[model samples]
Target: MPPQRATLLQVAQRAGVSRSTASFVLTGRHKDMRISEDARQRVLRAAQELDYRPNLMARSLRTKVTKTVALVSDTIASEAYAGRVIQGSLAAAVAHGHLLFIGETEGDPVVEEKLISDFLDRQVDGFLYASMFTRNIRLPKLLHGQKVVLLNCLTRGAHPAVVPDELTAGLDAARTLLDAGHRAGIYLVGHTRDQVFASRERLAGIKEGLGDAGVRLAGTIDCNWWPDSAYDAVCRALDDGLTPQALICLNDRVALGAYQALREAGLRIPDDVSVISFDDSDLAAWLRPQLTSIALPHYELGWRAIETLLGQPGEPAVQRLPMPVRRRASIGRPPAE
Candidate 1:
């Protein structure tokens, strides 16, 4: 048989004190209980000597706080690119003296409900409802009336959420091109369906930013937000005599496609045509000219969502974190007409 574990009774006996006195000392309630310093020292020494370990389950029975939180998401944990989000949440949870349990639902409602029920059964202190991409989400009914914070997503109205400032990033993209003397012949390369949150907000900001300069986009090259689609659309546009002075792609992938099309047409990046995009992914830097893009702040979003949920009490409101710009060599002065 394994060695017997030391208990509070054993510790009390070794410390030459009553069970209540040893309990008060171990729980740090000695001063409140008017426990003697000498007794406290003796109890601590006895606990050390016996290698006593408090049972967390037993302590939680008295405290009601299990000192743990759960992070439930739809495919965030599996995405290699989203690893930083989990890292950020883990760091914040640990700093607050709590353990973190992660679960991925893969957008399945039944699985999501089961996962959430399991967390609730364990009595996790709080919840982080996250999404891989920013959008409006329908929170599971099980989460109602519980402590929760939305990560990279939001609900219908006012709620606690941590999302990137995509609108401001769009505005900055416009300003970046305009500041480089791009007066006209600017084209936006991406699908601009208003049903999508990021697309609409980004387009609105881009319009507002360019309108402030009293300029407007020459046109939009409608295409799916991907490399091959972007490449085909841009190539066809160029073949049809579309001489765009600059292209503001929706994301880094679209930017890569635009780069390929521009190069194939013998139009050097930032020489004959300038370029800018968003997401600031690793692909942005690996490009030939290195695309100038706005960052998504993935890690910060995860960290701040946990903080909002577990930190000091605050009014429930949406928190839109800033998306900083990562300037590179993709943009420059407009070419001579």
Candidate 2:
């Protein structure tokens, strides 16, 4: 016959303590109940010997707090960047003694609502609406009365959010180019009205930096946030006889395409044209002339989102994690013609 499972009574008997004392120690309330240290240790040892595992459902039912937080994301596991966010968020949540429930919405609000409704039914402690990009999407109203945290998302009306400081990213990119001694024909590649909010901000910062140096916007082309678009943009610039000394791409994808365009046009990078971008994606390192880029703090954004939700609530805090420039081989002085 199988060995009989140990019960709380058996543990109390083994510890030679009152049932109430055993309960307090096992439930981690011994300090508040002023249970003796020796007695507490005995109870703990008894529990360990018994390999006692408390039923989480029973505990949560009694406490009325599940202690689980839901992280709702649009295509979370689909993107490389989203994976980093999840890692950071999970680490933070675990450190705070909270379990995380991950839900992927595939960019569908209806799906997100269903997941949130189910979470609410389960009495989840909080909600985190995470998006891959900083798009101004409306959150589910079912989140009312629940603590909501926005990660890599924009909350328009008095909602706390954590995002990359693209303004600094742009400035840093400009500073790199300026430091490289390339002033004439500085161009911004990729980015249009439909671009992500972070993209727009980075572009604005780049423009601001250039303006400070008395440099005018040379030209811009929509790269559709893709490598192909970037290549096309470079080709068009070449056809127009526009040889920019510096090309600031919107992100790694555009930078990759820009490199192709320049190579096809027989222009040596940094020697004939310098290239830089935002996001500092893995592709940046693989490029022939390693891409110089602004490294956005994606992981920190995830961690901060959880921290803000648990900490004391205050006026909607908008945190911009600083994005520093990652210098590499893609930038250099313009060739002396």
Candidate 3:
């Protein structure tokens, strides 16, 4: 009961050209085939009028290239900030004339296996293995030797990767406060864990940057990376008469907690204690005095990974995109002591 789809023969008949000519024109081989420009245009126009579309399935069977890519992620689609990552991937895929299919595995190995198997069965041209956060990830064994690009994550193996330069961002964070005349009473407002890639790299950059200036963090508040944990820790620190001139939080969420704690203790931001943080999320700008923080290049990570995968052939390389500093009202000169 369904109507038949328009055929290439119909387009060729309408354009008054041979089927081979029509095929060449539609498949972007007109120049190689030495077809006339007029004939190519006529075939294109006829295809448009008749709604004739080449069957990708048949073409892929012949070419052995699907011209499609799959993006497999662990809970990446669930986060709001990471939407830009998907956007970047989609844009680059479209630019390369490839279709992008996305699948979320929710960090479940069984689900991940099934999702990847399904994509493989469908003969996807390539894969983008992405993570919601930047960290070390063991790529799926199934993905080995396949055309793949790692997004926002890295591995020991040499698979092309694109991640935010968190280390540089950390160095910038420290320098931001130092440039504002903060030499002492500077405390870190989040716990640093070696297992976490961002934590270790950012902390190392901060240390190196501060050390370069012949200074160091006065103390650490040691709190979880969440607002509530940071709130309690900062509140305790303040109650114990910890008078920090400036606080460098590990993330925007931690900075939010520090802000609440500072306000409750009759301390004004950048007036009594300047504050700076990382991860320039939506919450960063929404703060009372917009928080000065380093931005995570979520969109660029996705875009660059896809480009690395599908762009000019090259050796597998890890690409760490720069994380820009988003300056705002939160940073100021340390209060006159």
Which one wins on lDDT? 1
Candidate 2 residue lDDT tens string, 1-337: 9887788888999999988899899888999999999999999999999987666787899998787898988886578855778887888888787899999989787888898888899898888888887777676789765788788777666677887887878888887887787778888888656356877788778878877888766788666779998898789878988878888888899899999999999999878899998887889889998988888777787788888876666735777888878888988887764
lDDT of each: 0.92, 0.82, 0.91
Report the C-alpha displacement of residue 228, candidate 3, in angstroms.
Answer: 0.9
lDDT of 2: 0.82
Residue 237 CA displacement from its true place in model 3, Å: 0.6
**Where does candidate 1 stray beyond 4 Å?**
1-4
Per-model TM values vs. the true structure = 0.94, 0.93, 0.97
| Error of model 2, residue 94, in angstroms | 1.1
What lDDT score goes with residue 69 in model 1? 95
Better of 2 and 3 by lDDT: 3
Clashing pairs in 2: none
TM accuracy, model 3: 0.97
Best by TM-score: 3
**C-alpha lDDT of candidate 3 relative to the true structure:** 0.91
